[model samples]
Target: MTYSSDYLRSLVREDRVHRKMYVDPEIFELEKEKIFKKVWMYVGHESLVPDPGDYYCTTLVGQEVVLSRSPDGNINVIFNRCGHRGARVLNRKRGNAKVFTCMYHGWGFKPDGTLAGVPMKADFPGGVLEERASGMVALPRVKSYRGFVFASFNADVEPLEEYLGEARRGIDELTDRSPVGKIEFAFGCHRYHFDGNWKLQLENQADMYHPAACHASTVGPDGRQFQRRAGKEGGDAAFFTANGEAVVAQTGVRGFLKGHSSEASLFDKEQSGGVWDEYRAMMVDAYGEERTRDILKNRRHSMTLFPSVDILIAQTSVRVIRAVAVDRTEIEIWPVRLVGAPDVISTDLVKYVNITHSASSFIQSDDLEAFERCQEGLKTEGAEWFLVAKGLGDEVDEGKGVLFGPRSSEVGQRAQHVAWRDLMGA
Candidate 1:
């Protein structure tokens, strides 16, 4: 069924949204064109392809794309399709190749995505080879903010920094945590898929209301007992052992324009002792005492960069959302390493990601169950709309397109739909 712009806008009301937004395949196709292609989407980080000739193949907006580092020390995002036979040029997930040779026809492309040579010179048209028109197509816009690469299919889209807006604070918080002010997507990643719309995962990142209930088993008394049995007392386990109500009460949610939002830290700064003290000293040695205090105190548990990316600040990982179908989504969690920090810090981060986001993890599995249930429940014909009225009228308008609300509020989810309507309607 074709939906008009007016109808698309009507699907998202102030306090409720039509269920079709989550279950309609046509709407998902429309989202690919109107929302995903028109915005700056996270592709991959520069660290993924640091050296010249290094390349990493990944998906963006349901299309195969590659990030390649050129000899000029610049990274380029190019379509992975062969210019000759339309076959995928790069099959490997990552490698160091000066030229990508198509498996089908042996057509070669430089790291910068310029046509280099064709297998048979007389077989191709003269102009196609001479004009470099047959080269793999490079994305129109590719930019990186502090090593985090983003690409847009729309050439006329807003600048990356302006697009990030207040969301830059989240990135800053992650990078500043490193004494050298640099972070890398090291320690590999954990990739998983769920039978649910991409928005469900996006909204859950900033959601504080569901933790007390949805994650009760993980953070409740029973889970604490299990942790105690496993001899886990401090660190991240402390966050799980804390009273659910007390944690929710102390946390706050902040929403920004264009569907960007962040959840305040779930736990306070670690008490100064043992490795914690050593870490604090390292930070103090790098940044002065005042700046170090500010950096350590202003903690954000997670930050959702509209459309596809969630920065798990405290866990030192990034979750990238990829929409596979209207009711199916793929998520990739990449653990980050704080450069110049102690090896133990990075090691602990990887361990935390394994316990919380791995396919067999309890926390992530519970959330996936909820997401699947939401997908199934939305299929019922009995309900036409999904209510998102929690904290609807109580959101404080923190000027400059930011909304401040209680941790349990749906302000972030509402803001996302507002941006969705705007993009889909346009």
Candidate 2:
């Protein structure tokens, strides 16, 4: 069934959205064409291809693409299809390859996606294999900000930095945590899928209301969770212990334009001694005492860069969301290493990611169950809308496309649908 623009706009209201937004397969296909293809979707980081010949294979909106560094030291994102017969060129996930050759036909491409060689050149006419037609097609627009790369199919899309707007501050908070203002994805990643709509994961990232209930099993009677294996206090325990309703009220949620949003930090409790103190001293040395205090004091727990990526600052990780179908979604959780910080800090970040996001971990497992349940419940024919009215009118518009409210507010979810309605309507 084809949905009209007016109909799509009507599906999203100020306080709720139609259930068809989540359960309809047609709407999912429309989303891929309208939102994902038109916006600046994330495509790995520059660190993934540090060397000239290094390349990493990834997907955007279910289309396979390659992120490679050319000999001239420029990064390129090109379709993984072969220029000859359209077969997949690069099979491996990542490698240092000067040329990517197609197995089906003896055609090769340079790292920059230019046609390198063909099995028989003289067989075709001059116009048959022109320069433009002989090479893999690159996405229309590609840009990098602070080492994070984004690509868009629409040539007329807005500049990446401008699209990010105030959300860039959330990214700054993550990178600024490092003493040298740099971070890397050296710790690999945890990739898994959940049986639910892609928006479920995105909404849950900024949801402060569900953790206390969804993840209650992790917290014990003592109000502590995931005690450090090093026989020490603080760390993840500090975050889990403060999951009560009263404590959550202290934190807040901030929504930005283009569907970006962030959750205020819940683990900024002061650290007095041990490795944390040493880490603080390192930060103080790099950035003076005043700057370091500001950095550590106002950390953002998580930030969702609409439709694709989530930056979990407290865990030092990045979660990439991929929609497989109307009901199935895959997620990749990449742990980040803070540059120029104590080795223990990086190690602890990885450990936290493993404990919180790994497939076997209780936190992610619980959330996945909730997502699946939501998916199942939405399939019933009884309800036609999903209410997102919590803290609706209470949001304070702080000028410049920013709306914020209590930590448990559903304002962030509403902002997502607002962007969705506008895009789909367009």
Candidate 3:
């Protein structure tokens, strides 16, 4: 039941994971080149190119970057090709281009990607249209911790907050739930193209154990809003599992690494843990309760930053998993508009993160039908190896991540496929 390459690198045994590592295709092209081209992905935020020539177009972990925001405001990213005939220069998905027209044989770029005018400026008189660091290939590693943003075709990784360990405290409890601590992404994204393969939606967002049996009675088990207001108008079912008691006190700071790891609410406090009382009663009416409890309990956790960030900080949401193979997957769902919530809780957290975590979700259609029926029964052949030995030897290495139990424990999907088989060596 193993497909060579040393039996798929011995299907990772110190705590299983070998359903052909989610049905291989050369282990999904070595996890898109050693874990999404050497990490730091999440590319698009800063209110998605706010103003100037604003741009957005995505894909990193699948190439094609683009990101832009030029015309003085700065923020570029680049690489949507067209370095003269490499074609595809901003093929939509976002726009406001003051200049990037490379509809082949016309060139012309600029807006921090230089080479701005090229329509026969003496038709190649001495032929050098902005060479030296020529532009357009600009991602020599981009950063942006707070307003999200990230990019890297690997110019030597590790810097995005030391590659976000302990999940940059889930981007500092999502920009301290914004009392101008910064958080923006004004209602736009809802994208999802899942048949399933993007690490099975990062093991269903760090495996929250299918919310009491796959979103039981539907996502409102006091996890907030799961209907049943009978005895006098709502609240019970232990008030939606005690409104996820800080996601069960974040399964004791869930851990794991090699790419990244996380599991459980990392501090949007308030399980009587003091400091998150309705985000300190609306950040004490705009920064007061000791600077709003040091802006909602001084940050310390939240992460999933390996093959492309997932730091969902109690729902500020940044989930991105773009594995364009093993069939098809690109669930880029981005949403972080909390900044100081309460426009009725940011319009009910933008309709509960675009209707219960977007991509037209019915609770995301039972996690896309259990990751597309486990990738169609591991693409049949009487199914050969798919065991991730669920909490094997009862997972508890605790050197960083293993102690597994609830929030649907497969222990963050076996510490994310043993850090995706040691960064795809399997």
Candidate 4:
């Protein structure tokens, strides 16, 4: 659907958006250039490449980029394409590479993204190749906030902190929960793909109204049978109830600026068992009892950072979404470990992801099914618009670029499209 900028803007209303927004191939292509390429996207955590020469390969928008750590303790995010033959210089997903040597031709670049060696130095004029900037091209801007690294192709995008806005609260909560103010990304990530638009998962992550309906089997009475069979009676109930109640406890959704949002999902203290006791003692020693309680018990479920990733603080996971096409997306979920917390704390967090949101997770399967069905349904000629006016006029000001409303409100979704329209100039 070829659309003028004015027409594109017309499709997005404060309370509703055209169905084409979710189904249009042309709109998705425009999004890659107008939004994803221009925003500060989460690449990977600094812990992913802790040592010099360590690198992680990921994509920004659609272009492949490598996040590498230099010998001088600096991080560099460079295009993976070789300066010589335009082939990918790094093939591995992640590794310790002293220099990236393109397999196509023999071109090598240092971890700092500078040209290191050429296959035959004498083949070219002495300083001609070197003077032509023959090296991996680094991204224009890169920054880290609390060890979460972000890179931007746009040279003039706002600083990471300013861009994050109130969304920082959830991220800070994630890092500050660590007794020593540090967290580690898990060694491996669990990846899942869906036959749907990438925005489907992003929007679904914080949608409170759907869980009770979509996940009825997993969290309802049927779950008790599964719990009993696994000798884990009441475990499912405790998990679901704690998160479910926490969502209800919140007065509204927090729709922060730039399409970011977070919702509190405080878990019960008993769920942590002795692990919370040990972690709490450490935190209390570092901080007072009141602060310790606030740190451990004040849980934020999903921090949806626009365009790419969502930080799942309560569950100790970081979910990165990558769009492959108009109706294809890949999601990588990484469980994180707090550096100074008790070993059991890390185990519990990782196990939560496996049970609740992993590829085989009972709860997540319901969501995936819904997303696929929505994609299929939207393809048919029926609805002209997707309604997002829930609690439209009832939203309350939460101050600091945040709007709040009932848990079922589409405040987050409305805020998200607002950013999309502004970014896409539509």
lDDT tens digits, residue span 343-422, model 4: 77787677778877788887778889999999999899987988888778887897888888675677888888888888
Candidate 2 per-residue lDDT, tens place, 1-426, comes to: 899999999999998899999999999999999999999999998889999989999999999999999999898999999877789989999999778888888788888788888888888877887554678778899898888999999999999989999888877888898999998898889999999999999989768788777877887666666743221434644434344453454577888899998888766445446677888888999999999988876456788999899988767789999999999999999988888987887887778888888888878889999999999999998869889888888889988899997758888888888899999999
TM-score ranking from best candidate downward: 2, 1, 4, 3
Question: Candidate 3 on 124-205: residue-level lDDT in tens?
Answer: 6474555534447788788887667787778988887766665566667677768777777777766767675777777666
Q: What local distance difference test score does each model get?
A: 0.84, 0.85, 0.63, 0.78
* Most lDDT-accurate candidate: 2
Model 1: colliding residue pairs: none
Give the per-residue lDDT of model 1 (tens digit) for 85-147: 789999999999888899887889999888888767887666666524588899989999988
The list of candidate 3 runs beyond 4 A from truth reads 1-14, 17-29, 33-41, 47-50, 54-64, 70-80, 85-107, 110-117, 121-176, 184-261, 264-282, 286-300, 310-410, 413-415, 418-426
Best by TM-score: 2
What is the model-wide C-alpha lDDT for candidate 4?
0.78
lDDT for residue 357 in candidate 1, whole number 0-100: 82
| TM-score of every prediction relative to native | 0.94, 0.95, 0.36, 0.92
- Which of 2 and 4 is the better model by TM-score? 2
Model 2 lDDT, residue 244, Cα: 46
lDDT computed for candidate 3: 0.63
Model 2, runs deviating above 4 Å? 227-234, 237-246
